[model samples]
Target: MNYWLFKSEPDAYSLSDLKNDNNSTGRWDGIRNYQARNLLRDEVKVGDLVLFYHSSCKNIGVAGTAKVVSAPYPDPLQFNPESKYYDPKSSPDKPRWVCLDIQYQQECIKFVPLPLIKATKELDEMILVKRGRLSIQPVSPNEWNIIMKLGKLVC
Candidate 1:
């Protein structure tokens, strides 16, 4: 399975919010960027693991883990005019955006902070350390293992 890092603002949709969702599963939606949208639509799949990173918050870091529980599907909000994510140019026949579902796995006990990740020599090549502006990113297996260890969670 693929390994990915999904960034979410804690204030908007934190790992805690995901854990508290019904069945601890929630739709990962509102991805507007074409690059991020393409990843969700074409690459991400069911059973893939996710590093739930809390961004734009006081504690910016990989907070926990999640598992992709569904295949990519057209984001329902895109069709709703009232939704901020709605796209006037998109329709049911031609979707311009996609999203998936992920289930909460385990919260990190140690809370691997961003500074800690950036300082680690082994994580020097991590996309997070290099170019982390993307809301979604790919994580190498080695990077994943190290981060999991740092988070004090079972690999």
Candidate 2:
């Protein structure tokens, strides 16, 4: 299965919120960037591994692991006028956005902070660094392994 990293502001939708959901899942929405949009709509698949990253705050880090438990589907928020993510030009026949359900696996003992990961020479080539400000990015197998190990799940 493919691997990915998804970031969300803790204040808006924290890891706990995802965990608290009935099925330990939630629809990832509000992505507008073309690249991030493609990842959510096309690349992500059920069973794909994900690093749930907390972004835009002091707790910027990979808090836990999760799995994409469902196939991509149109984000309902994109069709709701009340939602900030609503797109006026989108139609039911032609969805402009998609989202996936993420099921929490387990929280890492110590979240691997962005700063720490950046400081590591091994992660220099990671998409999180090379892509710069991307809210969602692909994580290579090697990089995922290193990170999972760093999170002390090396076993």
Candidate 3:
């Protein structure tokens, strides 16, 4: 399975919120950027692992892990007029966005802050260190393992 990093704001939807969802799974949706949307629709898949990163908050860092539990599917919110993520031009027959279902794997023993990640020599090549703003990003296996180690995971 591939590795990925999924960023969410703590106030909007924290790692604990994901963990508290029914079966500890929730729809990974509301992505408006074409690049991030494309990753959800075309690349992210069932059983793939995700690093749950908390972004746009006072505590910005990788909070935990999750596993993609479902295949790509049309984001229903795109069709709802009341939704902040709603797209007026998108139709059921031609959806502009897609989402995955992710289940909580485990919280990190210690949150790996952004500063630490940026300072680590092994992670200098990581997308988060350079790109900083993509909501969803692919993570290399080596990067994933190193981050996991920093979070106190044996993997």
lDDT string, candidate 1, 6-76, tens digits: 99999989999999999999999999999999999989989999999999999899999999999999999
Whole-model lDDT, candidate 1?
Answer: 0.96
Return the candidate ranking by lDDT, descending: 1, 3, 2
Query: Distance (Å) between predicted and true CA of 78, model 3?
Result: 0.6
| Ranking of candidates on TM-score, top first | 1, 3, 2
133 in model 3: Cα distance from truth in Å? 1.1
Candidate whose lDDT is highest: 1
lDDT of 2: 0.86
Q: Rate the local accuracy (lDDT) of all candidates.
A: 0.96, 0.86, 0.94
Number of the candidate with higher TM-score, 2 or 3: 3
**Per-residue lDDT tens digits of candidate 2, residues 1-155?**
98899999999987888999878888788888888999888888899999989998986889888889999888888899999999988878898988878898888887889888899899999988776589889998988988898887642
TM-score of each: 0.98, 0.95, 0.98
Candidate 3 lDDT over 1-155, as tens digits, reads 89999999999998999999999999999999999999988898899999999999998999999999999999999999999999999999999999889999999999999999999999998999998799999999999999999999757
Any residue pairs clashing in model 2, and if so which?
A: none
